[model samples]
Target: MTVNARSGLPKDRPAAPAPPPPPGWRRWLVPVGVLITLVLLFLPGMGRGPAQVDYGDLAQQVAAKQVDTLRLTADGTITGTYASSFDGGEDFVSHYPTGLQGVDDTFLSQVRDPSVVPHFQATGATGSWLGTLLALLPFLLFLGFFLYIGRAARKGMAGGLGGIPGVGRSKAKVIDAVRPDTTFADVAGYEGVKRDVTEVVDFLRHAEKYAAAGAVAPRGVLMAGPPGTGKTLLARAVAGEAEVPFFSMTGSGFVEMFVGVGAARVRDLFAEARKRAPAIIFIDEIDAIGQRRGSGMASNDEREQTLNQLLAEMDGFDPATGIVVMAATNRPETLDAALLRPGRFDRQVTVPLPTQPERRAILAVHAAGKHLAADVDLDTAARATPGFSGADLANLMNEAAIVAVRDDRTQLTAADLSQARDRIILGQRQGANFLLESEKRNVAVHESGHALVAALSPAADPVDRVTILPSGMALGVTEQMPEEERHLYSEEQMLASLAVRLGGRGAELVVFGEGSTGASNDLASATGLATRMVREFGLSPALGPVGYSSDSPQYLGGEQVTSRAYSEETQRVIDTEVARLVREAETTAVELLRSHRPALEALTRQLLEHETVTGAVVHAIAAGSTADGATRAPVSA
Candidate 1:
């Protein structure tokens, strides 16, 4: 279906009008003159013949009165139309050496009588440097023409003077000399993704069996996931397993400033791929060119033209041709519908964040060259990194190695891995031990608030670790680790989470008599979750089963132009509900902190002394265990 670039709507095809012919005689004038000049420059001796006649012989001929017509030129060359044929033509000329005393006009006039042909007659100018240059002009023009064509063909021009024939040809890199050294084995985890791509490789390897079974091969495969999830690596693994040609290009590489250039590149790419059957063409970051047509305000004719060409090529290719198109995009939702159709990118292999086991495998793969101490456990590291992608895991291993090097140790220890995880998650510790005593006390109370609330709330995730030590953008952190990844959240759990987020502010207000900016991050998080609960999750009674919030792409972030989707009155109600949810959660946190002031003070003292505390210690303290665990502590407000 052809889409209108402006409206993005499909319509009936209209025949294109013929282009008007160029106007005026001037259009053909330069070419005609050039042709004539070329012919004249190389024309066989118009009125002259080549002959090495001696000057004395010419003078004898003139004295014998054999020369009828004599012509003298400005350069002192003399030509005469012979009375009878001399060489092959009627005319011949010889240099009248100017070395002698100035030419004798009377003697020259005597060469021919005035009655026959005028003596000392004027002739065309003799050959000089100017004439030599004119003679080479045609060859020079031809050389320049070829050179321009070569340049244009080699590096596609952007149009205008740079316009060269075949400028639309694709700049796609052809990898024929070197095959992908990476196989599926080299890639860690993503067993499902590997299985998906492996089928394509299998089809390429044994096409005859599938053909006999009456199965048509998938034309294209799309790997969609977050960035650095091993999409490109998986495509390379497919290429390696198949062991065929791989044509690699990015979506941006197709388009040029000139119109139709992108379309030409798409054509050229497929043509090249078709020539090498059983080949894989991988396009990285395909969202750049594959976005829904006519969706944006600006009309991009070049990009649309390229997309049309790509669609045509994908539809035109035979599955049996052994050409598979593979593409990777972090934003698959943005791609055009035509591109994701069954005949195009029929297979979509989603590469999600690695699971705990997968992360362990990924760590092991990246840890191959590194020396790990006996205490360093991949399982423990994997458990610490839940939402980490494959790339993140690889980076973790690299950072751990760096940490080991910084400590001047040859082997990576558990501490190194833990520090690396902290760096990756919370960022590097800032200000180190530079906090003032009062600031340290404040930070301790702030984090203690969060840890205490999480421990007291039955539905909240357990605090993994808490510290008053400043890191990155935060003055302190309260890290929570879920025992198992939870896909669904209960209302009570969400409420508890919101309360925990507000715990720090509630704690500060209770002990210090006022809240501080240190709880700014916690407030923001709690507010957002409360708003989501009311507006999106339909958890608010006032906003009852209605979603007023914008529907944003889950992974890509940001709303997709969705508005409030409700009346002003309903919006007010939503705002009221959101505020109420946050208030209720904050009130619960305040009440909980007020009831456990003794525990808060004890935890704050521990934080100020240790600067960091584990969730186990917080749990024990919250359970009424003494600081030394020998005596029970009474909880008092």
Candidate 2:
């Protein structure tokens, strides 16, 4: 259901909003004109007939030039008869000497054509005017037909009224405030974002406080977040909270193949926003219009015009009138600098990924009425998920309920929750994907290394699940469930985490004497984590606590701040450091494996049959190494 522009609350008795008017003339007139032209320029048909002749009289005329016999029957009908030197085919042998050859008197007594005797007395005839007209009509009809079809062909080739290329049109969606479902309560994990945005809403709700303080309220709020992180939702929530007319649309909505449409729409939007005065304008994914200009040879004049109008409108607005503009985008890097500066988008708020505690809270929100069994622990579930966002948490709850329903259960079980986590992170189990037994064994060993190292390290996160089932990229995943929600990770903790990642490839080298290409994801992850450690965190021997990113512009338009975070002389050292970190962990694992080879073999056998085995199962086997050690139990149900 769509929202109402004037009211923030869900409209109990919905208003019949007027439908948007039809699009530009290019959408219809061009097509209709082509159709008319085609009909007007069409082609027509032609037919054939045989030659008419009279043989007896023609031959006689040719033989005797002067006494030419006429092979004519009275009333212009004639029949043929063969003879020497020409003969007259008279209707009833004319009473005079008709210049007829082989005329015999016996012929009259032999037979008589009964009907012929009556018509023998008649003579003389005219012509057929209708037939003559028909014989001359084909050329003009054919000319007109060709003309019509040819015109149609030309129009079809042109493709548009003006015959322009690149008919790429942007989508249009407008948000109304009345039917909006998002509230401040629906948004999760973005406290800073919420606080900053709440102020904007407050400014919209009560402008006198800010104005009286001589601190003019923000003209525009730029919400920056990755996709699916609810920047759009927050914008709607602002309108919902403020109780004002909200004009919501997308950045792409204004753009068109015709150059000036975007700029025109920008002017129209702000004009309407200002007219409404105490109003809010929300543009979701506004970067489509605000992208950096002059990056390539193509002119950004169209976008520039649109942005210029937007900037002018934003700057020209009176603070007392209470017009708040809000826009959201994932790529802040791509936006124009002028749009992000003080007067235009006066404030920028970011909504990032949810922390563990936030995930638990989000899960609780979704799990409220679902029969999630008293034994279901959201805290544990949250800890089990590391990179989950608000949307992911919502899906996790929904998927758990689906699993419950599929299992024909009245309440969601711990096993169901575990399965939900698996489905959310890895993927649904494919029953029969192909894999050689040898390759499967190798995958099992590789993932086992990750789970083992993660479990063994005191600094590492709690191990969640290890599986050989493939998803988007990795063939297997070793999910590490954290002990609790953590605000930050120490430099030592980050290093250990890197070690855990390398453990997979390390184990491959330890056992098989060489690493397979299966470790591509692992290597990429390790490299990224290590790079951040040096460049961002300044944890390298070559560099001090001075961050390289600090010197780099917030807009990232500048150059390098150092001669590499680590130099060519240090490249080998960094590689050695990384390799040293990896090797030490591998040796530890290999020694551990050597001591508990039997357990590793048993677990690998179990994985081959199950396709997925949880952290609890692996921990059980590892803990079983001791005669009296307690296994890490599953989250109880």
Number of backbone collisions per candidate:
0, 8
Q: What is the TM-score (0 to 1) of candidate 2?
A: 0.65
Model 2 poorest 10 in a row by lDDT: 111-120
What TM-score would every model get versus the actual structure? Answer: 0.72, 0.65
Across residues 1-637, which tens digit of lDDT does each residue of candidate 1 receive?
1211212223434657765575788589889989987876767556545455678788777766667777777777777677754443367768877777776665566664665344447776767655787889999999988787666556544432246555667888887667778888999988788888888877766676677899888989999999888998887777677656789999999887777788878877887886676678899999878999978667789889888888888876333256789999999988999999999998998988888888889999999988999998888788788889988988998998899889888899987887888898889888766788898899999899999998888788988889887777778889888877777999999999998999998999999989998887887888788888888889988778977556553322343554446788987887798789888888998998998898899999999889888888898888787436533234332
- Per-residue lDDT for 156-233 in model 2, tens only? 522221223323222333344354777888776678888998887776666656668888778788888767677877
Best by lDDT: 1
- Regions of candidate 2 where Cα sits further than 4 Å from its true position: 1-177, 189-192, 317-321, 401-412, 469-473, 505-517, 534-536, 542-573, 595-602, 605-614, 620-637
User: Which pairs clash in model 2?
Assistant: 3-179, 4-178, 4-179, 41-148, 41-149, 42-145, 42-148, 43-145
